[model samples]
Target: MPTSRPNILWISTHDINPHLGCYTGIWPGAEQASTPRLDALAADGLLFEQAFAAAPVCGPSRSAIITGCFPPAIGTMHMRTRATPPPEVRLLPEYFRAAGYWTGNTAFTDFQVDVPEPMYDELGDHTHWRLRDDPEQPFFMAFHSLITHESQIYLSDEEFAARTPDAQRVQKADVPPYHPDTEVYRTSWRRYLELISQMDHWVGTILDQLEEDGLADNTIVVFWSDHGLGMPRGKRWATELGFREPLIVRWPERIAPGSTYAEPVALMDLAPTMLAMCGLDVPGHMHGEVILGPDGRVQGRSEYVVSARDRMGEAEDTSRSIRDRRFRYTRHLHPDRSPMGHTEYPDNLWTWKELRRLFAQEAQQQLAFGEPPSILTDLQRSIVAASKRAPEELYDVRNDPHEEHNLAGLPGYADVQERLDSALDTWLAEVGDLGTRPERDLLARWRPDGRRPRAAEPEVDNRDGLVALTGTTDGSTIGWTTDPPTADRRRWQLYTAPFTPSAPIWVKTWRLGHEPSADVPIAAPAR
Candidate 1:
């Protein structure tokens, strides 16, 4: 391992399942994937075979990644709603900045909480580690790729042709049994695969830039996706396909080349793992435990990974999933509603329309994935029908990797169900499962009378030639800019330490959930 601190580069993608070229035979239904850059990356780095997201939806999943806490535990289980987190909790970047490292995020989105001001040294499309004033200082640079996002799966034909000319050859064999063979679905799936290829190109460009800047060798490159594929039963559901994520970490000094780890790992562990790699203390409040360090993988890592789902758009439901090595068990709290209950957002998807069509055909004794008389499989019916969902589902992932068969009802897996059920009960109690508290109650607490609490205005004091700024607000971070502030609020610098100002500066105090105080100006001290 290197003696000095290593720069960490985090690259996150959206709505992707493990269909990489490297996983050709390993992960079924992705044998045709062509990804040279990612293949090379896997050859030179550590590829985690069983990485899963804390939540299936993008917003809630991202909330878990940024906070290093499960959505249910942190009051961020809802899909797109914003709520206040506990005061003691801090975003991942804050830890890097506090450790005297330059932090930059090319694209920043923490949908769980309303972050009043930019916390990183740089944020936005042009943000980069090179922008840091001190070249010697270590950095944590993060960025995201939207090429493989949900919306891209059903691009306009003209747009799709521009990106992928050969995107219409997908067949029934390429798709799982859950989906019926249809032209619209075939096209959407083809486009999704091609986008994954393009996303690899995007990743290559960033890595190329890192090497061009001579930071590759000393930098730890971590690549991951927020969640899995964005099909009908993919992104929002708590199924195996929905929660699976691709994780690759390349740090040649410490991580062995071409190595692979098959242990189940949650995306929430990312923040603490990064901190551990950087030799920093992992905060006690974080729900994730560090999984890797200088000595490689942690001993006695977590046995099971848990995920959550709640109120996706207008769809109202709550479900929790627990996965051990060979099985995944899902318990739907609201069994009255079908797992296929419509959410306006995903209902627009072509695949969702296809699923609905299949559901109607099956009702008329017409739909089939394989051949005539096969009819709709139980998995397909469960996914597309408006019928009530089973209270619980258990899948033997080792035997049925697609999770088509539910073992919860079967008598043989009694021990498995009991063990997983107990584990889930224990976890819920330990975390206090803030999700049990009504979202309305949480909203009321976060925003009284539908208005955010405001932080006290920041005050600046001149100590000799140094400028010291503070606000009476108990726990607030400050953001400052010059008199003629730039239109882009992201340019505001965080006030972490006293500074000798070159010109007059403006400052404001901001807490996570509170409204930032009005900008107050401070004159430059005498030279």
Candidate 2:
């Protein structure tokens, strides 16, 4: 018999926060979210209790998983992607392609290429794994479920009317106290859960096809979400829900059935592990590491894993985070701005309407009691503002899972706060993150011309403590750090170059016009 390499299937859903029975241990329905497929998949493989996406938002987070690098490291901190991967930066699929595995992406490929115009294939339905059933070739396929996308407009009036109030109650059952308890809010939750059910059905269909093709045993299946639910205190930060993902890794030959690993793991760690499991090189550019030894023993890393968020959708400069399973600490340069919505992006509009109704209800109750309307707490107000965020936030995950408490200034935890802050600061300095706004300003200054160069855009490569900026309006150019930037460099790097799929460009320290640079040879500077 010929030696066989396991085929890989990666399935991702948008904005799901591990609400499935397999991860949350609480399903929406009386029997739990009806997910026979995912439950079966979990039974066959290893389940990761503490897994995180690279970033909390979609575009940037997805990019990090594919490339095994940070969003800022690649100048892709912005949530919406107009940047293309440089020729030198190979995505995971491309690597598999090089290794002779047929690769297919069904739903989304946030990474773009150098084509001058959008390819004719661009308009086709997102890539599907069904295309990868070729028996002659080993394959890698990725599919994303998008019905859970963050938007209140996902429901029809008829659908909302048809749902029983009891059915809708579960949506609000998981609601955090900080948010209002109202029917509008409750109804929104119902719609969202319905979408989750739809996603479950999709998973079932895919699983059936895999079995029919006799690829079930030969394939290593991985199912996860890009981030948490599209709700407040989720998706865009280092909170448990934001980073905690639903991971079902099934490879029966290598992994025993009904196995669960509580050891905290970063999603970035998955890339390296996959490469190692496939018996391929974990490229030098990848910052992630494999958790399991070749002998199949678990070789875990630190007690804590770091999660980062910058700008996304419309959100602006934020900061990196460090969490040690119990506590999360973050440091922000923009103290005045609400960390969440400084660069606001329209979010679940349905939730917004629900909040408005809550506000009205609260006010009416206050008047009926001949009392003043309760003023919103800082945290509650921030949740309602949608775009509001704070420069600094600290939470003890054990006591406050919703991240409602910001303990940055609580006197009792001074020592813990100092330790976390110091650690976070040191990591930023070592990683060459001058700070979000400052880096933005530098990239903008380097690209003075309205247009950025598309062909030679700077990519996230750490070489000699200097990064490069390429594809200037005048052609290939350079940007470098004469001195490593401090917290003052956070500003948006504006350029005229169209942030299109074809004409890629970026802002960084090394100049492409100058002598070429090499990858940063050491691990990122420690905080």
Candidate 3:
């Protein structure tokens, strides 16, 4: 008999904010990239209106979702792999592997955790899953699509021609107020839509393959983007457009059709949810919760979904946001950092790489009204660079869903600001956030590769026979014995992490660490 354990299929797209027809009204039935397959998935599953990414960018958010913890909490706060993981910190697939599930990650695993650690089976990109070593075992697989990625590489001449008319007709450009509006901008936008269309086709192919395998019914299929649309709102900051992502969970036997959840949910919550759906206990170290029903619909949104930022030196930002049906309140610990302080230049149009020089030329020295005389000053430049934002900005989402108005210092909206401020303060206190006050030096201390000792010889503990090596920085990568040393020079498995105050990392197993024969069990310290 076929087992009842739910097979998990998590599909993630890169740099896609909530621009789908069902999530944002701007693209509904529009000639611009239509997402019919995605829309159908939403209809069949529970659609989340306020689902947020763990971080604004991919590397951080991916690390958080995979581990079911915040990036900073796990020393993966930076955008890439920086440290060797502690042996005991389990991967999502590792937990499922314990439950007798065959785990395969086809597309992406940017978490940077040490490989050869025995968590998931990497099946590269073959599309055909039935041919695997174990066919009927329930599984967990993540497919990350690069089709909607920010690049001119995905755009073709035909697509460029198809969007040229709309490109020329954008009357005001409504260009995020932070970016430069140039012909280059319009061209990039035009090509971006083309890329989105391409993404839709790629998504359809994945769905078709799932059906072809005849495993669609029993599988719990979840489709979501890592973050927002690849525009100004895509890469950095904590604006509604940046963190909010499209989330669709489909399970025919579990979720009710055509259901929508308006409550806010963070990507951090996904890890715990997956674990719960599989009837496993969420680890005590995880910070997220499981809110989805067995049928793949949300029972309710989180009371509050908080996002924090600690970019590398460019800007040290910390923000706490709380959103209900009516209000979205954000308290910035370092309001000065705003989006303008970062070099990511998310404001550049989607395929801006094609016209990078042209956009740079047009954007030179352009300043906003009442900007400082010396616009080069860091503070002044930030303000001028992001003219749309204020030190304290508030928006009544009920009236202005696009967040175009600034009600922070306004006469009538003072009450709203006060109320929102109170909410932010309470949340900060609860989360142990010190506040938005800028601490530039503290930020410097948290830099990914700031200062660290070079890896020395592995020091074997004479008492326990286990070799211990320390990391130089938060995300530093180091290799060590898979288990306690026995006789000779065994190969090493890479591990990364920052020290956890609660439990120190300790090794429990050993293996012949040499290449190819790198199969071994390394028990990490229990969190």
Give one digit per residue, the lDDT tens place, for model 1 in 127-194: 88889999999999998878888898888878876765433233333667767667776777777888
All candidates: TM-score: 0.93, 0.74, 0.71
Query: Among these predicted structures, which one has the highest lDDT?
Result: 1
Which model, 1 or 2, shows the larger TM-score?
Answer: 1
Tens-place lDDT per residue, model 3, 1-527, is 22588888888887766666566553221334456777788888888777777677777777778877766555555544443333334567667776777767765667734433445545557533565577777888778777666644235667545533322232322334333455555655555555555666677777898898888888888888887666544466566656767788887767878778777787888888998877788787776778774545564545767665556334555555555555666655565454545454433434334334433333553443433343233322343343334556566766766555656788897887787777766755654432233343433443435542233222323223233444322322344443345636343334333322222233322211112222223344444
**What lDDT is reached at residue 93 by model 1?**
83
Decide which is better by lDDT, 1 or 2.
1
lDDT of 1 at 99: 86
- What's the CA error at residue 1 for candidate 1, in Å? 5.6
Q: List where candidate 3 sits over 4 angstroms from the true fold.
A: 1-3, 24-31, 80-89, 112-116, 126-128, 152-182, 295-297, 312-317, 342-389, 411-419, 426-527
Question: Per-candidate RMSD vs. true structure?
Answer: 3.1, 11.8, 8.8
Q: Residue by residue across 1-527, what tens digits does model 2's lDDT show?
A: 12488778888888876666676543222243545677788888887766777677887677668767655655655666444333344456645665767666664666422212111111125555555446668877777767667653245776544432223223344445655555554655566666666677678778888899878887778898888777655667555666667878888667788788876677777777777777888887665668764434567776656667776656565667777667887766555655345334444455654555555566676777866656545555665543435666788876776677888888988888888888766655654442264544645643455344323344454445333334433322232222223435322222223222111222443222122333222233323
lDDT, model 2, position 190: 60
